[model samples]
Target: MALIDFSFYSSIYSYNHLFLTVLSFLVSALIFLASMRKSKLKRVNLPPGPAGWPIVGNLFQFARSGKPFFKYVEDLRPIYGPIFTLKMGTRTMVILSDAKLVHEALIERGSIFSTRPRENPTRNIFSCNKFTVNAAVYGPVWRSLRRNLVQNMLSSSRIKEFQHVRDKAMDTLINRLKAEAKANDGVVWVLKNARFAVFCILLAMCFGIDMDDETNEKMDQVMKLVLITLDPRIDDYLPILSPFFSKQRKRALEVRKEQIDFMVPFFEKRRKMLQNPESDKTAISFSYLDTLFDLKVEGRKSGPSNEELVSLCSEFINGGTDTTATGIEWGVAQLITNPHVQAKLYDEIKQTVGDRAVAEKDIDRMPYLRAVVKELLRKHPPTYFSLTHAVSEPTTLAGYDIPTDVNVEIYLQAIGEDPKLWRNPEKFNPERFISGGEDADITGVKGVKMMPFGVGRRICPGLGMGTVHIQLMLARMVQEFEWSAYPPNSKIDLTEKLEFTVVMKNSLKAMVKPRA
Candidate 1:
């Protein structure tokens, strides 16, 4: 009787399994059909952007050259009419060339239009992993890391303490420029030196190492290794080529391993030194590494593991280098092009600092220099798109659906130079920033205008520190030296080639003659 009962139940169970399987497939089929129908009806809702070739989707179509982002986007505006849709690989990017749209999307409704950078190989590297600023998605971990940076690296108190660092770096930068200044018209790549200074100083703040020539060289090599590994190789975009495209991945692993080997020993050495109470005083004074080891400042108890440490150190650099340096370089280029503005800036600096070395304390007093920086920032922001991010909430813009996890960008470069926002958009004028006569702060103009530091929640946190360095270095250098092009305008090449960041096609080689 027991065996007969078991058989009867087993038979019923088999039928039930079959019935469930059939029902599931039928429901799935209905869902699939409904999705297909919905997809077929849906249309891309954006202003007329450039129509791209089918699959590649405007792969390399952007400002191929200089800070004429207005001109670059204007080429499309005539056709697409201010708002336009563009594609980067399979992803869609809406370019808001108009300032109002930028404000509407990126500022007022920023929760729906915040940060995501999915382009290139970041997705592969960090999607499965949880240890980076670049790859961490828009969520708690990002907020945590960002908050930590604010408290430890970029806070007002920290910056006040680091004023000496900037002052020293400024003195060093000026001394170097004066030393490098030639009697004859010897062309120097001013941008190259500026990039090195920005990275070197920021690295010092990040790792707590005072940058000397040898240390700077070592830092440069590490940064170079990182950049080579980050270049956007096309093979990774397509699936079939993925296996063959493992070379970059392999190279990155090897590079990362090398980075770890370099940083781990250094970290341990610092850690041991920090263990000593005497070292704690000198140690906290020594570098950012020791500061992390001491108290649980910034929520993180200690520096990341060897690999993570190196990546974070590298992250401390990332855009902070290329972007600021590029902006400053463009500032120099613009000043060089428009000597009238250059004379005005030099006059202001001379009136304020008066042949004496620009004391770091005096920087806040120099409004025109502040204006020059802000105006340049307004004109030539490096990233046409703010570091891209996906929308985490259902949002609407221009009556279009911004579905959750959909990617978006704030085209600050486009928005900052919009004719409607500025009195004279195309002209390079610094007076636009001097609102309170000569005593106003120009670190950034919020809401009314988006400075290059970016706007709202995901704005560049390092703005104060970053801006000070550029102004101190570049302004001092320009004031202390007389820069002129390698070849006079008739023979000068004005071509521009923008790579990881923008560069003069021929490089900004100029004769650096000492003002004295």
Candidate 2:
């Protein structure tokens, strides 16, 4: 009787256990199906792009393309039809090559496309936790910083105030080039001189003092090292592989420390000077550093911290220097390559300002020179894609569903070279601005014929200063000297290398004779 009773209970227990197990499986299946359906619903109408592999997405193809990322994107435009998407690891990057779409998305719906990517280890450290105006996500901090910079340092009134700085720097540059022309048999590599002059100009504006060659060289090293740290790595795409790049990241941190060490002393010195007014010292007329010292951000007990100040000052100097120097490089390269253009430009400069140094005030009368600079920018933008933009929220762009936080790369280089827009687009023709019936507004307002400085709300704050520097430097070079390809019969190689800025693969070596 006992055995029979035990068997009956065991059978009942087995039946109950089986029923619960089946019920659990069914519930789990239902949940998974619901989730998949929800995911499908969420991923509606994403832009058409190269079909990607799971997990890796199109990253392998992108790497295998044997081209710069921007060029690769441009190549895809013909097939993908202007606007297309690429998945890099888990991240979605949308490329906007169509001017209409770029205008529609970045200008019309700017509020959505304005913010930066979420803070990551790489960018956070690079920006001192997004204290910089350029990398900072669009928000109160960014606005405050930008307003302070624009009003104090970069505004038209402010830029005009800093005219003396640019003039002095230009004079020094011309003098140095003259020396080089004499020493190098009328052949000079103008890059060093160009870089030095722009650095000095930006340094004075940034730090309220002129740095000596040694100091300037040291700062240049620091900037180059810092820029080297910014090169994209595999870990940037594959976060799971980040540990392998720990050494690289560590080196970047060390470089940042060195940069801060070099920059922070200026901030402290300025602070001390402000505090002690009676000290025997020449007061700086005005400087971005001085303005930053006085900046008052809401909810902050003090102005920007020294680290933040260092970051901003670094950005001010480095951003303007390399980009402007590159412009001069490319402009000079084109002048060397297209001697007819050079002759026309020299004639214009000579007519505009006879035997006088080209000054900021003189830039306006030289329209041909202005057109040359615009053409240089169109042909060889220092930055292929303007600093990357990220989506603030999920939205449709050009009738495609763009999800929140995806990367958006606007192809400025491609836009400039689009055959549909410009006649003989590949040719370095400055006269296009003069007679081509299309506008040459670099500011991207009258439509983006060329956006070397980018467009919309996030347009480079340094655009005004950069344009002035490039024009003055180029004009002065033309006015004061005759430049030609070094070692006659050699072509000025326009081969490009993607550096911190797109630079001449070979440094511009040219023969320059000082004009009587």
Candidate 3:
């Protein structure tokens, strides 16, 4: 009986061990099968891209080279061809290097291209709130708000009416610039001061006050925060750490609060003031706050929620501020680098203005002057690439089946520099915009070639206003001073680095010899 019991126990243990081993193998086999199926399913007919290692995609590409890593993609355009594909971690992006393809994707198929919203790190304070015009989804609300903004704030007639406000602001800028030149002996903090002054003017016009010290500092901090957050990274493409790391998220919320602290009170004050029948209409001409409040005051328009109101107000100041200053700086950088371009520009301004302030109307007449500005924009668009337009739905492009929820990033930088479109692509030639000639008509946002304010339905609504501001300001600044590169290099370096916007790797520093 003892011998039988021992054999029975040994047999039972052996069976159990064998059963366990079988179960484990089966589980492993199932996992492998499942993973392989997913790999095949996800591998739709997409364009080929550079081979990336498992887990990390082009982070190594960025580390090996440039700040705007898009430059690397620009480099690859010749080899892989223009419409190459990229896989940054899990994120798949299609780059449109050719101008015709860009227009096909963005302009011709506007509805398809318009769905991609601006992504994380750059979504700013207005991201969550959908009521604000820019953040709203592609729908009725967006159409309504965009129309209102154009008609009320950005129309040519409305812009013409606000000529004085723009003029007064420019005058303030010139006076302050002159003071800085005298005080610093021409080594002024031009970048910071130009940024601040432009911010102050735009903020005041929008909200009736220059942002407070606390608020201004907060805005400055947000600018720095955005630069770090907007870094082109594989992790950002995949969003694996999005939940764990909320550094960018926290910064966005904090920035919004600071903006609200300054904007809300001003919005409220304007609303109350406009309610009065005897309010000063003269001071209210084309002002931002007035338009928002006008709707409520007249009871003809439905006003946005107080939060929405403040968000809109904040974006107005934020969008307009950096853009105007950046445009000026970019033009200066271009002019300094291309002395021949500068001389022609100076001569055009000299003949048009004759020591008078360059008026808005003067800009319309000066075609060569217009060409210089156009070329500068083509060369260095402030925002080289805005957030890749998200493919909210499945779409077809170039016969490729673009999956839903993918991003289609049309590279404005590449498109502008495409050899097929612009000859001698590296050369800075303003005369390329001359009409009735070889590949001309680089005239306006509506033109086929270049788009600084972006393109298609998502084009910047404030483009017209922004264009006028840039032209008038550039005309005046060049007309007012004979600018020369300080420390006298043969020419300006014209190198670029992409921050939140593409800025000169070297700050646009120059000797401001007065044009007597």
Q: On TM-score, who's better, 1 or 2?
A: 2
Number of backbone collisions per candidate: 7, 0, 1
Candidate 2 local distance difference test against the native: 0.75
By summed lDDT, the worst window of 10 consecutive residues in model 2 runs over 1-10
- lDDT of candidate 3 over 154-240, digit per residue (tens): 778877876776787778777877887788667554466567656656655675543465776666665445434434332244455
Write down the lDDT of every candidate, Cα atoms only: 0.59, 0.75, 0.62
lDDT of 2 by residue, 393-459 (tens): 7788878888777888777767888888889899999998898775666766767667777777777
Candidate 1 accuracy as TM-score: 0.80
Give stretches of model 2 more than 4 Å off. 1-41, 277-283
Residues 408-446, model 1: lDDT tens digits: 554555566565666667777777667623222222234
Per-model root-mean-square deviation over C-alphas: 13.8, 14.6, 14.2
After the best TM-score superposition of candidate 2, give how far the Cα of residue 320 lies from its true spot, in angstroms.
0.6
Winner by TM-score: 2
lDDT for 139 in candidate 2 is 82
Model 3 ranges with Cα > 4 A deviation:
1-37, 40-42, 54-67, 117-125, 208-235, 246-248, 277-283, 293-303, 435-447
> What TM-score against the true fold does each predicted structure earn?
0.80, 0.89, 0.82
